[model samples]
Every structure is written in structure tokens, then in C-alpha cells.
Target: MPDADSNPGNGDGREADVVPGNQGGRASRAAALSVRSLAVRSLAVRSLATLRAAVDRIIPADSWPAGWEGGVAEYLTVDPISADRDLAWAWPELISLAGRLDDEAHRAGADGFASLDPAAQDRILAVVAAGSGARSFDALRRVCWEGYYASSEGRHPAGLDMVGFRGVPEGVTPIEPEPLKTVAPAVVQAHYDAVIVGSGPGGGVAAQVLTAAGKHVLVVERAPYLRNDQIRGDHLHGKRNAVYWPTVGPGPGHPRVAQLPDGDRVLDGTDDASVYGLNADAVGGGTRIWQGMAWRFMPEDFSMRTLYGNPDGASLADWPVSYEEMEPYYTKAEWQLGVAGEEGGLTRRMPRSAGYPMPAMGTEPSRELLGAAADRLGWGWGPIPLAINSVPWDGRAACVRCAQCIGNTCPVNAKNGSQSTFLPRAIATGLCDLLPDAEVIEVRDGTGSAGVTIMADASTSPVELTVSADVVVVSAGAVETARLLLASGLGNDHVGRYLHDHRTATVLGESEHPVKPYIGPGHSVATLDHVHADTIPWGGGVIVDLMGLLPLTSAGQPAPGVPGWGAGHKEWMRGERANLFGVFAMGQEIPLPTSRVTLAAVKDRWGRPGAALRKDVHWTSQQVEDGMAVQGARWLDAAGITDIRRQGGPATASAAGEHSCGTARMGTSPENSATDPFGRVWGTSRVVACDSSLHPTNGSVNPTLTIVANAFRVAEHLVAEWPR
Candidate 1:
């Protein structure tokens, strides 16, 4: 047979360059028809050949298409290895690994690895997998699997079909993309009444309020306003996919240094899904791809310090403003943003002034089974409060109930976020100037007016410009907010202290019968029985059904003791796809003073220092998760689910995760907090810290809803007391 690499158009090597994203592999089959289209020039000819050979052997043609045919070669050459800054260090190592394979083939009396027969290739790969290069080989194998399973653009059909995924229904037409109308840097004015230095929930709400009040507002965002399709991707490459870089997350040119629990400092780029602290960086922030679990902080959540009494060195503190003050705003957010849920079951635990704007989503088999389990366990269960539309209420269509919901853009524009709800309204008022792709580096506190120095297109063709604003609201998330304040010589010593997020525990279970979890929203039912349990002292978290897993995600997660790759892993995936069910408990993370965000020594693409994060979760958080996990296992067992596997403990490693907040907490005094009760920085009169950075303590659920409610409160306060 002719060498595969030498003759690119050979039988097996025909489909080389067409790397498609995962759209149930239905559309990917057409995409993976050619290899010459992809830019293989960057990779050495010999190295590319070896990669193809290695991936083909790893997932050889066994009734299904081989790994190389599923666009694994393109995935390896085009994505993280060549383009990702965080993984740039691994490029040379990967190249070396490829070279090692070729060298091994030479030792076996072959011209190169690609020239070897299938059996010979498998033997060489097996030898490497068990030898010194095991780790590197494993990494290569992981990427290959991701490529084959995830599909770059829904081009690989075999992987999706193997897992029984019926791609987006044939007749389902996606909602028309509503692109943001933004102000170009060249046309932006010098000053505005108020400038919000972030476009997340906090900044979006602030803009909506300020703009509605007829105040000229400038909303500066670090990321570009991505269209609906751009964010949708091929379903497998969104915010939830941990291994691959997400669509809404920060891309190349952005980097951060994270200090691990073992005290080792590692350089991480914005694209490093796990290490760099993955959060949505686009206009909507985390809300763009959030699961839409709209939850309000319980009344008792406002007084963690008063209730818990600072146990186990946790720096717990009560919010300066109580839930009573925030209740109206929470209502406003739920109604204005179009939340869908029933208030009947939640009236006692989560007291609301008014009912949800829309009714709860229809019950499905998964929810019914879980609700039954909760009933049997004597737990209080209810429809999960969602910011997704159950009816066509807010000019957007209702959700199509697609399997891929969380971490993905809603195909129907039903999932509400800052981008979908607030920013659009803010822009329509003609008073808001939304500038996307602009990074506000510093807020210069002038004697007369506040000046914000912004870098337009910081990633490519950087240009620095200083624009003035009467009030500068720093709503740039917890970490970035602290970094900006620290870098600009603003805020007190208390800035960047007491960082935390919801300590989450994911318990996966396998049911004997088909639960059909991949039918609608990833999660449907939830139990709040543990939110403030009497048994445990520190307060437990909400136990909800976990998001549905994509084929790639499932492929990456092998059950404990199962091999990560090879035929055994493949068989396990095929059998477990329909049976697997997940339960997630989001426990409260006790804020610790030691956990913080500061400036890193490394510079970004624009020559500015990146943020340095050191996070430490309290031991009490572990106890909370342990309690939740036990309840979760019981619930699963009640539902006749077995083979339970629990993951996530203490949240020490994942403290800087999606819900990271409280770095610049608000309180009564500057001695204990970075900002005042009204979210105003203690020293800076016109500058305010909005966003979850002002969260005194993270609650026991997803923080986006609370962040939205608080942003409404802060924006109202600013509007009432604008410096005239």
C-alpha cells in the first residue's frame, strides 16, 4: 500500500483537512471529506504523518470510522497545540513525541511511523503508552478523542451516532442572530455621564438603569459581542466543555498566573479551560452560557457571619444590605429578564414578593424520576428556577428544549442573559454606547473627573485611548475587578481578599432503564431541602440534576478503574451513554482571607500585567459537599440508579471557577471590605465596584441571579445619587 502521509488522497487519508465541530456527527460527515484544505504547513511533514498514524491506531477503524477520519489530525494541528497560548509550552513537546514515534518506527526497521502496518503501529503506541512517554501519549490520545467525538463543526457522524445522539432535530430552525450594535473606537466620545467597565450581568444592569434614566453611558467590554451562531459553535465547544477552549471565554493574548494548592505558580492563558479559571469573557459575561439556574439568595444567606459565627477560620460576613432590600430588585430581574418558575413550592424557603414572570417548564421523565426520588427521601423538591422562557413573553421565542442547553447559546433565543435582556434594552435607548472588544486597563482617579484608559482590540492591533467619565463602575468580575483596582493603585489593602465560589459536588449514577436525560434542558428538577438543613450547622447547598453530558465530555470522563483510552473505553462509552445520570450539589464556599487575586509578574499581549490568583477553600466547605454528596447518592439510589461515582471535594482546586466572587466585598467599613455598602469604593468617590466582586459571601447556588439582583440595586442607587 502507498504511504498514507506521502499520498494524502489515498483511500483512508482522503478526509484529512475537513475538521467539523460536533452537530451529532450528522453534518460532520460531509465536512471530513478532504485534508488538503487545512493549513498543515505549520506542522512539519514528518510530524503530521506521525500524528495521523498515532491517532488512527488509538481509535482504529473498528466498524466505526478511524480517529484520523473523524478530523483528529486537524484538531491536533489547528487548535490548542498551535493557537492556544496556555498550551504553547506543550507544542515542542508534542512535536518531540511525534518525532519519538517516528524514531521508534525506524528502530522497528520501517521508514517512519506512518509507513508501518496497523499491527506494528499499535505495538509501538502500546509500548509508548506504558513507557516514559506515557503522559505525552495520553495527552495526544485525549485530544484525538475530543476531535473525533466533539466534531469541530458537526462534521464527524460516527462518534455522535455511536452515543445515540439525534443531532439538532431536522426541522428546528434556529432563532435569527441578533448582533449587538456597538460604538466603534474611532467614533466614541471623550466623556460620558457614567462608564461601566464590564458587560456582564452587573455592568449590563448598570447600563440598563443608567441609560434608562437618560444618562449617557459607555459600556466597555473586554470581549467582542459574538453573534448567536458564533457562540453556539457545534455544541461541544462551548463554555461547559472543559478540555476545549469555549466560544465565549477569553481567547489568545490573555494570560494569568495561578498559584496551585501545593504552592507551585503556573502560567495560564485566558484559553486554559481548567487552570486559567474559566468564565465567560464576552458582553454577557458568565450569563451568556450559564445554565440559567435563576436562584435568589435565601434570607439567611445574607447573614452567614451572624449565623455561622466565623467557624474554622472562615471570614464569613453579613451583607450590609439585607434580602428585604434586595427582594424587589430580585423580582425586577426575574420579571424583566423573563424567569420561568412556579412560586408556590418556593414561597417558604425562597420568599418572593411576586410570582415568577412565566410558569415553570413542563415536566419530563428525568425530572419525574428525580422528583419521585426526592419525595421518597422526604426532601423538598420543586421546579428549578430558570431565566429561560417557558412561553414567548419577551419578544423571544420559547425554548425548543434542546439537549445541549447549559454552556451553549440557546438556538431559540429563549435563554435570557445580560446580552439578550439588559444590553439590548440599554442600547435601544440611544443613551448607551456599547463598545465591544475594548479592555479598560485602569481607572485614573483625577482631581476633577475619572479617566478610564482603554485598549481597543488588545488582542490584535492594540490602540490605547483615555476616555473620561463622571462615574466609573468597575463591574469586571471578581478577579479582574480586583486586578484592575490593585493595578491602578485604587482600593484599600482589603481588596482581592476573601475570594470564593460555590463548592460543587457532582455525583454521577447509572440507571437500569432509560431516563432520557438528553431530551430537554440539562436540568429540570431541584431539591432545596438541604439549603438550610437542621442536621448540619454550616448550612448545606441545593441539590439539582446535573447538565446533560456531550459525547466528548462522556468520552473524557471514564468511570474510576476504567482505562482512559482504547477498545475497552470505547465499549464503556457506548453502553453508558443512555444510562448515565448526574446529580450536582452546589454547596456554599466559606470565604477565606488567604484566598486572593493580585497582579502577576507576566505581561499580556498589550504589555500589561495579568492577574495572579491564590485560592484556598475552607475545610467546612468540604464537609458541606460531603453532606450534599451523601444526600445526592441517597436520591440516586432511591431512583434505582447504581454505580454512583462522586467527584469534586472541598473546592480548593476549583475555587476560582465560574462563580468566583467576593474578592472586593462590600461591607460597613473599609477595614473589612473593599467597597462601601452602596458598592462605592471607600477612597474613590465616583468609582464603584459592581459585579459579584462586591459579594460579601457567596451563597449556596449559582451566583448569576444574585449578581443580577445586586446589580439592579447598585444601579438604582447610582441613578438616585448621581453626582450632579
Candidate 2:
């Protein structure tokens, strides 16, 4: 019935199947598989069939009273995790495993695995689960749970009533993600007074300060500000859907060669399938997404080498600027950004200049439990400072106390992200050009003649432009910022050296009474009791009482070695969702030269160099995290938590968190660091490093406040020194 022009097909009177299938019933089989995207390849049917036979052993339906109807293999066939390279690479092996198991069952007097009794199937699975087959088994299990428990069927009346999960409230109407191309045009000018590479907390603050000082600042951001429309409280996209990270990006597929014991494994940011490093790409950087834990480093954090002395295999050094000088800017950030907290309990290394602009956010049941536990154990505990409006500051609405806040856009415009704060203010000043989807490939001429080569988002029409500026401020984040500098051959040898991030550990506690961690802000309580080493190792950090994870993350992780699908994990969440609490260690890591960020062999999406990050965490840093994890477990026990599960310690594998920093490190001289005391690149007069990269070492607390404060400090210094 179709026109020949519109419906071009073979003249054989048959339609061609885009899905290349292997058998004569290929068309029929492929159609069935297409519904669940199991038609990714010709062997998809065989792969999925093999998978179903194998998955039954790990997550058996007969094991539960009202069990999941063996749809786990279907979920595994379509879940995002299943699409990734880690699983895809092992998928063939898994298929082989299924065949081998079936063959074994045949040899053992049974027809096959599916025909064998449950006992026999599990016995065969046990060998695979214990040995190298554990890799494929764990991968299959993770996706199975993610798909099953993250579905409406899994969180049914039977389960939801048990867990008391109201689910993420759907009051705020969701909108489509907005790219601010109309309001903020992509018109690249010939020149400007200054150019900032990123639009994060640091870059946003710097833009506000510099533009207010009457400097024409051009802010280049690789990602568009998706705005409030992107917030849907969908745990699938916002939370543990990516396991260790949120579903954000480095934009245009910046690949990295992460050092592994076996060999170098290449990670392409553009290719979601092979994600090794995760960083959000947007106008406001991480501030648009972070939960906002605002805290200043203790005095000892600055002078780590001065106080503890640099240990073996560590690159510890004193910051050129002191906490005393940074205190004014810290106060400025707190007041200007509307941070809320009281200035008492667990005495700090130094006193605050003034109390936080607003009072602390309301507490949850976990806070009470933690305080009581701390009191009983004679350990220090207190409320954490938050960057949300307690009583509606700066015309932003007050927080509605949303449960899912971390790594998500604020549902009610209550959160204080840079996109809502400094960038807006900077734009209002009419002196800053906030250009989103502008990826800076490199930074050159660090002195009076500075310039950057930028390309529009690859998804759009390619518009490569070279914008020159009098000054260059690279705050593209620790990794990308360092990569740009290294690519341009700017600054000293330390340009890409000393990459670091907080070594974290977490303890999930199951309380006797319902604590209901989903009632308040995601991060409401923390204690600075252990700012420095009192009894632990050389490094010290704060232990915070974090909110319970969303159901998606919770389902995947119940206890170590526990099958994520079927009975154990789902049953645990049903009984304990309300009573779950976590103790998180946001601790420090000494800068190590070996843990450096360099240019990777593989090019980015724009044909530019990618980052080759070598993260060599010292054994002592692991010791600090291990010690904190041990103490956190003890605290949970003291609070009368019946069951506690600890993750991350000395034995845990090293992976980068959202807080990775300190590649283009700042110091006094070119010999040691990339930037000077005022954050100006040592070899250049005006070009500077303004983000957490300016930090000589990552302090125990979250670095957003410090990054912004330093940005303000550098802006002030530039305002005074530069010819305005």
C-alpha cells in the first residue's frame, strides 16, 4: 500500500529485516526479542535463553512465597548495566558458561540445567560463583536486581507496604530539559578581558567577582544547564543507576587510560558502555547536582607537611595561602551563597568569623541516634552546615526537605546551586558571557596574551572557535583543567601531577526502630570530632550520619556476597528501609606524585587529547579510611543497630569519587606547583587555576565551599592587582 519512493525495498516482494537473524524463523524470533531489545545482535536469542537458564539458579522464583516471575533475565537483557562493556566483554563467556553448565548437568544424568532440580542447579552455580565465574555471576546479579527491584512490580503493595515507601513524591510537575541557547546566545566574540574554562562553583564565583569588578569575563561550559526540568526524583538516572557515580558526564567522550594491575584499560566518557571516570558536565558544574555539604578545612589541613611531615611516597606540601587569609572569603561564600548552620559543638581548629547566615537545616532520626551513640562512646558529634535556605534567603524558596537530594536537581528551587546563584548574579551584572555547550580544547599563552580553542557540542553543528582573552582562568575541574594545561604545554612540570580525591568508607546500619532516612535533606548531620589524628593514622576526617540510599541502590547492596535479586535483598529492604542509616567517611588523601593526570593516547570526541589518570593511593591513606570505617561500625553498634554492613577500607578497590581534585595544584613557585599564592599560574601574570585544583591537598570535608571561597579570594587579588 506504500508508495515506491517512500517505501524502497527489494523487488523480491519481501521486506528486509534490519535485525540480522541467524535462523529461518529469524524474523519471528527477532520480533519477540525486539520488545526487550534482546535483538541487539543475531545471537541475542541464544544469549538471553542461556542467561535465563543460568539466572534461575542465582535468583530462583520457587524460593520465595510471592516471588518474581523469572523476569530477571529480561531485565538483564535490557538494563543499562547489561549494555556496558564490563558485562558485554564477559557476555560471550557467560553464554559459554550456560552451555557448559547444561553440558555438565547432561553428563550428571540430568537432561540440562533447566531440567535439573534446584539443589543440583545451585550446586553447579556454587562453583562458578566462587571461582573466576564470580565475575559473570556478579555482573548478571547486579543487573538482575537493578531491573527487578527498580521496577513497579518489585515495589508492589506487598513490598511498598512492608517498607513504608511512599516513593519520590510527584508534586512538582516535571518539564523538558532546557538548553539556554535563546537567552544566552552562542555568539563567540573576538576577544575578552578574561576567560574561565568551567562554570562550576569556583568558575561561577570567579565570574561574579571579576564581572562585578568590570572585567568582561567569558565563561565556557561544555554542558547545557538542563535546569529544574531534569529533576524527576528518578533514582534510575539520579542515583546508584551508575553504581559508584550518578548518570552525568565529562562531555564529548573524554577517554582516560586508568592504570590497572594487569594492563592499561581505556575509558571513554562519550561511550557510556566503558565508563571508568565520572564527572557531571553542565553550566554550574557539580554545584548544580551536589547535596551541598559546606565545610572549611581545619588549620592543620593547610600545613599537612608542617604538622605531620611528609611520609614516604606522599607529596605533602604546605599551601602558600593560610586558612586565616581564606577565612574572609569563606565567610563571604557562606553569607553570599546562603549557607545555614550554628557555630557550636565539637570545637574547630579555628573559630568562625561569624555564625552561618542561616540556622542549620532540620534533623532526621539518624542524627538523634548518632548523637546518642557518640555521647555514650565519648566521641564528638554535631550538625552539618548546609547550603540550602532555612528561611528563604536571596529570594530562593525554602527547602521542602526532599529525601532524594544528592546528585539531583532540587525539586522546589530550594537548593543553592551555582546556576541559581552566582551565574545568575554574574549575568545580571551584564559583564559575563555565560556560554554553555562550549568545550575548551586547550589553553595557551598564560600571560597577557591568553586564548582558548573551543568547539560547540558535537551533537550540534560543529562550530570551532578560538577566543582570545587577556587572562585565562582554568577551573574546568581538576582532571580536565589539568589536561588542558598539559595539552597546551603551559605552566611547570606539576601541571598534571598530584591528582587526589577523598578516600571514603561507608557503614550501612540497620536500626531497631524506624529511623526513616528519607524524611529530611539527604545530608543533614556530620561531626568534626576527628579533624586531626588523635588516635588514628596520620590523616583524619569528619564522620557524618548520611541518609539511607534510594531503593535502587539499596536493592543492589544489602550485604556483601548476598544475591541482589530474588529473596534476600528484597526481603531485607521490605523490613528495614525505614530503619536504615549510614555512616560515611569523607576523609583526606595525601597528594601523591604517582597519582597524576596526563594526556591519554585516545582522543576525545572533538579529536582533542583525553586524560590519562594514574591514581596511586598510598597505603596510609587507605589506613585512614579503614580506621574511619572501623570506628563507624563501632558507632552503629553503640547506637544499638542490630546489623551493620561496612564497605570500603584498606582492602577495598580504589575508585574515583565526585570529589576528585588537585591535579593543577597551586603553590608559591613554578618548581613545585602550577599556580602561585594568588592562584595565578607561576609562569604567567594573569592566567590562574581557580577550582579545587588550587588545593594543595584535599581536606576531609566536601570541597565545594573551599573551591568557591578560593575563587572569591583569587578574584579579590586580581581586582586589586589587574588594570581594571
Which numbered prediction scores highest in lDDT against the true structure? 1
Query: Model 1 RMSD to the real structure?
Result: 7.2
> What TM-score do all the candidates reach, one by one?
0.87, 0.84
RMSD of every candidate to native, in Å, equals: 7.2, 8.8
Candidate 1, residue 674: how far the Cα is off, in Å: 1.6
**In candidate 1, how many Å is residue 533 off?**
0.9
Whole-model lDDT values for every prediction: 0.74, 0.66
| Winner by TM-score | 1
Worst 10 residues of 1 by lDDT: 1-10
Model 1 global lDDT (CA atoms, 0 to 1)? 0.74
